[model samples]
Target chain A: MKKTNAGKKYAIFFCQQIDKNQDVNRRSIEKEFGPQIRFFPIPCSGRIEPLHLMRAIESGADKVYVVTCPEGACRYREGNIRARKRLLYTQNLIEEIGLERGMLELIRLKAGNNYTVDKLTRELLG
Target chain B: MAHKYHILTSPTPARFKPITKAGIIAWEEGCLKCARCVKKDCVYKVYEKRSLDSRQMLDSLDTACMDCFRCVQNCPNRLIQKSINPLYKALGDNYWTPEIIENIWNQAENGRVPVSGGGYHGPFSGPGFDAMWTDMSEIVRPTRDGIHGREYISTTVDLGRKLMSLEFDSGGKLISSPPPLVEIPLPVIFDVLPWSPGGKGINLAFLEAARNTRTFAVIHQADFMTDMDEYVPNIILFADDDVLKLSKEMIRRLKIIELPDSGNVMAIQEHLKKINPALVIFIRFRLSRNASVRAAALAKEGAEVIHLTANENGMGKAEDPLFIKDRIRQIHSHLIEAGLRDEVTLIGSGGVAMAEHVAKLVICGADAVAVDIPLLVAMECRVCRRCTEGISCPVDLENIDYAWGASRIRNLISGWHNQLLEVMGAMGIREIRRMRGEMGRAMFFEELEKEIFSGMGIKGLINGK
Candidate 1:
């Protein structure tokens, strides 16, 4: 961990149903990634406001990951579609304000049991 | 006891967490794990007390950090860094700059004159009010310090027409009926905001603050609620398109009513005067290329008060717009030339963003100023226009308690009043009336530039333009 950006803070906002895909233990994730890695579970990805995402960065998160359901697979029909539009808007606002690019990411997970929160966190670390 | 006007103020904290100017981006990646870490050396204890407010999604470190930079300097791995907060930078538009918003917020919270530690690092001169400098030539003399002096410096200003001369009968009795006039302790008034979160609470806050300060708040005829009856004395009914909405009782109770300039403006003024001869009516209109001509005509027409307004940026509506300061000067000069300057009151509105702008506008010829956006900013508005776009206000301005909002507004005015006193004292001007259009006590950047540098290029000079 003695390297630049190794201890960077992160926040992951995901749909609550995404946890059903794989057995993701929140305590285990905290034990491995340390307290800097934060989690926020929402009922649906579309419920997230652009203010929430911008506020995450303002709250000292180096990067934010918004995990949404796959296209057309959202239980709320167009929830994932709405989330994508909001994420795009938030990204543009960040860039327009001269903030670092790529600080925000929108991840659309496929409808399968192959994904886990722990695995997703490790993949982002790379 | 002789009535001495003073605004009582107390510290009123912000209803919501403010967007701070700078944020520390400290990454803990390369931890040497020293026996005594740099985070522990923070004298402000900002690092140890670091926590995120989930509701606001704000970092405590950003607001609590004194910016001593000790932690940044002592970090062995060079991990800590300070950068301008993007949210702070995006608070307001180009006209209402982030710095101005921050200053207003600080003043509202503490009701204190803002004093930055560092010397001024801003440009010497820019556009509009920045292009003029108030002469503080008497500053070295201790007696001129009005803020802590025994001498009384009056910021009071009258808000209606004045009689140029009083005629006497042969028996030495007054023969003319004196025109009614209203006076306020300060030269500032609460004007209608261009847009807001839109709630009764917001309007109540403005009215309450106006009542508490013994000043007038401009309320449109449409927004007049029955609950505002108690504040009638402090409310100036802005008669928009329709004057029939006003009842005689309401007119009699009110001290002033503003009428939008129309084709039959004088007839309407006369009609309103018939209802309450003691009432003062102010003629309101937008500033344009013909603003001076229109203002002089209005003065000649016996308009008690002529309120000239510019846009939010102090720019008039024209193909080539002039700033409010220049427009006020033009209208003032025009009225003086026509021998009508002493008859009417000129209340300048728009783009008065700071306390110094208040004094500067008066120096440029305005008798008083009407403020709009800064009052909203006192209520923690970021000028983000979210409320205007039908988006929820980030600060929850719609749900604010009117009493708290009123206190914050009062605090802001108190801060401005104190600063006004300091500026007047420095200029050795005891009364605000004398400060009006006193161009001899001020300096303009354009005139000084032309006087100093205009001759350089004409004569044999090095690379003169």
Candidate 2:
């Protein structure tokens, strides 16, 4: 899958299991990245499959992102692990199929991470 | 029994926290005696068991309610009015709140690890980490024991270097240093997640799990500054700073400290010089090629460990899944070339998503791996991706059932542990430590690329990795 134009190229941030507690960080992410990016919260990252990633690419997403909790910090513990393997497989598939692999990315941001959202956004937009 | 926490404590830094004193209580006047109250069996128990009058409930919800919506979910009559507690909102400057953590806790509890057959309701992949996926097609066979195990399967990994060359005295007696570091029983730890569960219940689960398994966990200093400080046997705290902002005694209790790899090695050296603690100093760096060079330098300069990662879900760095492993291998090989390979501990996080992947990573040269998204997935997270968009996340963790959440996590670990043992059995390795940084045993995509790069380009492309 390829991401071409910056306009039609929609980027999204998918978060799973966020609630009132995460609002603090969610607000922080929102405050830093206005409405340019869309957010999708899931029950857990493990529930995400390669099909979902591919569908996202097929669904007009210039780029798709998964903002999971820090490594080993998933509520289910393996949600992030399962999601990562799926992503890794997709990446390898991208290489094998001769497609651009930069279209999909997964990140493990925690509730209290001190990293700036702007830096994250910069990398995402690029 | 010197805990890892003892070696990594630093004074807590200043942080913004939101709180509210409003009571979600109800006084006398209106009484329908609704048998099913939302808070009746709510895990957080923000409400009293006694029947509340209308005025009392209205006057009280402002503060007592955490906005968890437990009452909202269980209210039969839907009589309770609820809203976000503003006071709690003020605690976080951006997104650090007890509520967010609670939500995650809820997700980990249920909806995930369904009993094998279930329904998945969500978007394919909308945004953020949802876009990333891990590969797992190796295991075609299935047995309840996880990896064809009849007995026990272990997941412990050695945390230090192996002898590049042991020196011998003139008498021919081999001389050995203290082996450099320790070993944990598990391949990974809960580590410090961006979010955490509330109360001592969940914390106890992690500690008990670690202790039972003889594994390590990275926790906040506040989790055990004193009361639980006694249980600091296997924790690695983030405190690789000067004199530790915490008290000296607390610092003394720590064994390993995780500091950011700001590329400033001197600061680490300087800190070490002051505290002079025997505990190892671990530098946390981004999962970039540049950081590998820094790791090499640190290893050469006597650093004990290097923690590298690609965000939480192991995304970014190289977008190609095959390339991601290649990058790790490159870093591992670079360190080997630097002659400090065996001396530095390499802990990798991000993209480490499966049992086979764990083995593959170890073969690629990581002492241990960390995970983020899997935990969420195990907790029943459906990567709707609309999370960052439109505010989605179905089970809505804000009002989670703590006990249920803990059980769900336990189930997930059980599932993964079974898989780990299977890989170990297939590799024919009895001890997990033997598997660390052993690249010779497994396979990589590049080698496969070389093996069948031409004759079947298209077919090879599909089955590449």
Candidate 3:
């Protein structure tokens, strides 16, 4: 049985601070999912600019997601909050250009929760 | 030169998906997955093309679904719904409202005046500039179309002092040489932003836009680089250095320069004139309790221009601060009483966040207005002031391509110029110079309410009597 969903491509931009464990079984997920899921770890979600998201979509992303630390928990203080606003602003821009706005999203990781990303990914794929 | 002033514009697409006003929520619980599921029947194919943003963890269904309500009504489980996005509500602050920021963004993207299909739905009166209304000439004379009409309406304005009386030389030739004047096609000038993360790139963009528009941008002398020499003709150096320290060649190359107002400002002006008489000097002063009297004195002393700047909210720095409009009126009236109104030009800055504020400031007494914040808005700034706090700007404005930034600023200015033209055309004024100090053509809420409602029959209604 296949461990990952087929045919759909997903791009993930996660903040490095959220999953500090470095070896969070991402390789197993990637190995199981193969090229269907791509992970781009960023220093902070605040570094996720509007162009980066647009380029991801323009580069053939079926969907793009930004994973960040929970509000008030960002290592850089307001990184998550700023990321949220930028994501929304980017959504509006894409909608104006005839793109579906739901192609982008911002996910906040629960503090001290190690299994949330995996669970969220599984739920999303399902 | 032809009287034509046209702003060339091109469509510049946004690099990111913009925050939309609303988002849709569709619950999947208790789904029967019927033969003809409501999702399959979505007119917009929102469900058929549904995908998840793995990064943001958002469902594409929310963004793609048009608010037709077909799915909401047809869904057997009634799982579909729409709600206003909280992020949309958080775009801007009290003064730089979200709507205004969005409008500026649209204008910058397309260089078109935002046209709402429906009638005006906003309140008739509110605080600040909204409380005043300009009288339109459409009812009396419908033939004149301001912006798109056959007749050319000029927006050109001169920036310099004018001689009160003409003097002749011994040979019967005019010897009272006119002061050097810089004529800009538009009455608006680019003012340095109060706060921005994008240092040189933003300044370059502003300078480029100012040059393209044939206007001036007030740049701090310290920030002026050697590479920016080509734009010197359109650059107004706000000099902090002593007049004697500035090279004669630098003064010669520049068209206009601004100096901070001080007790010895006249002496400094005279010293600058000796270096380059062609340079138009503008004294920059903060709007305060003594601004009116000070302005009158400066004009009497033969100051070429006076730039009166209020706080960010257009309020003075006094205990009981007057608004920019009131301060300008006071200065204008004081100058008029001193018979020096025609000697100097008044350029008002601060709290000029919108195009309408430009016209209102002019009507109150400014010959021109210097705008700062709207330019930042054009580049999609939310006025979050995170940059001021030494934090990274969410927009990454510092890395912005100068071309893109310049184009956005140009488009924003184009929108403003069109609006100014419309106002002038509707007021039966052909030139912006004529629009200045035309207070009679505009009605202030305070004045109108007092005149019409004061001592009226209705008690407690007029200010509760």
Candidate 4:
């Protein structure tokens, strides 16, 4: 497939445990999207602070997608929940700072699902 | 084979993006979307390399922009502007002003003296350290260039007691056993920070820099780690009622130890001296109302070094406080009156914000100064104090590479050393020892105002009271 989102930059922050298939999926995504997209694999989504999300936006990313494990299915118990709250906080801060809304999105992986990364990337950009 | 004293420094960039003084504001709403936008045509290419630092959440464009105003002027729709950054304004408190913080940052990044592009546009005079001006009458003389090594100006200072009078046996052979003295090349020593987002990495950075600079770092006895054994000679252990922590071997390895001025401080000093008679002991105390009398008394009581500490703003710790420079004057003159000034070394700390402050403090009476806050600023600490309230450091100071942090601290000291040399060169002083307590070479605001403008009723106006 050809990349269609011209000049649109996207950042994906995902938990390492959330996607066991990230290695394969990342390769395929890199082949398809190239430098237009970036992936950051963190230990847990709970480690994602407002600074990380805001910095991505500030760095000229059109949209930032944080992929977490399914709600309550986190190996660390509340990683996804904390990620959701931090995303909301960041969204509100950008709004107050005169930036557009919906820039920061939190996505939860489907329980027991493989290829969630591919599914989400296509679903968001398609 | 000892080499002449010189501080080696290299360009050590900050790990975090610094908060710039001004940030650009560009609006895309009214952009003509010119074939060649002004942003692309900028000489600095600030827009092309625009990125955000994750550690500080600071935009690179803000710092990279050289304030050339090309973009602001060339924007077709007048949509671009520059404004003072709120973050920069909020960097430090009144005492540690934003200008001082930025100056330290620049000095740390490059080991060069910070020369303002425009020649000296600050106020005539201000508070505490600013109120005193060094006599630079010999600045125009070319042969007195100390920084270029044309003339050897010694910045080395001794950190131990000396004999007032030496006795000799028959045939003029010396009989008195002189006390041990540790000479540091720089008049500046790294003191314990008033506050910091402290960690092993930070403490190690200080020790490493102290080792590289050949100066001392005042480490608390409790913070002394076995890993720091190699740096023991460069470490001045502050044994605050914890003299027991220092083993005989450790005491012997150390060059100096600082003890709080407790009731039995003399007994403790004597005991430490017995363990290592070559050890230099520093007696530390807060500067209070009767600090002059107390300093004289301690010197007569055989204190090796009197470390008089004021608050961070240079105000003495008392209900009615005097500035550290004034306090240093008082204590130094008191020792002189008691004929003990040459016998005891006096180290003044607190409120030393710049290199000039070091020279000014020495002129006011300190043998050398213990610097605290500038070391933190050199490591990109904004003095936000978030760590004090248990918040994670914005700059992530705890995780900084020790080598990078040490280089930054070393670079800062190198810059200060050069500036000190320049000041001394300008003042026609060849050595830092001669500059100490040279009050005639400096013009104090309080003194000058009272001398010239006193009849015109400019007394309180001197400090703008």
Q: What stretches of model 3 exceed 4 Å from their correct place? A: A1-126, B26-78, B138-143, B169-172, B241-244, B318-320, B451-465
**Model 1, B317-396: lDDT tens per residue?**
86537899998998999899999998999999999999999999999899999999999999989887756656556678
The Cα local distance difference test for each model comes to 0.83, 0.53, 0.78, 0.82
Give one digit per residue, the lDDT tens place, for model 4 in A1-126.
335567688888887675565534555565566557777655567657788897788777888999888897876567688888888989999999888778888888778776456667778777
> For candidate 2, what is the lDDT?
0.53
**Cα error of candidate 4 at position B119, Å:** 1.8
Query: Which has the greatest TM-score?
Result: 1
Who is ahead in DockQ, 1 or 3?
1
User: TM-scores of the models, in the given order?
Assistant: 0.79, 0.49, 0.74, 0.78
Listing every candidate in turn, what is its Cα RMSD in Å to the true structure after a full C-alpha superposition?
12.1, 19.8, 10.7, 12.7
Q: Best-fitting candidate, measured by lDDT?
A: 1
Q: What's the true lDDT of residue B194 in model 2? A: 43
Task: For residues B305-336, write the lDDT of model 4, one tens digit per residue.
Answer: 99989878888786636899998998898889
Arrange candidates by lDDT, descending. 1, 4, 3, 2
Model 3 C-alpha lDDT per residue in residues B116-199, reported as the tens digit of each score: 766987777877777789878756753554668887788888899998899998999998899889898888999878889856
What's the count of clashing pairs in each model shown? 1, 110, 23, 0
- Model 1 residue A10 CA deviation in Å: 17
| Local error of candidate 4 at residue B78 (angstroms) | 0.9
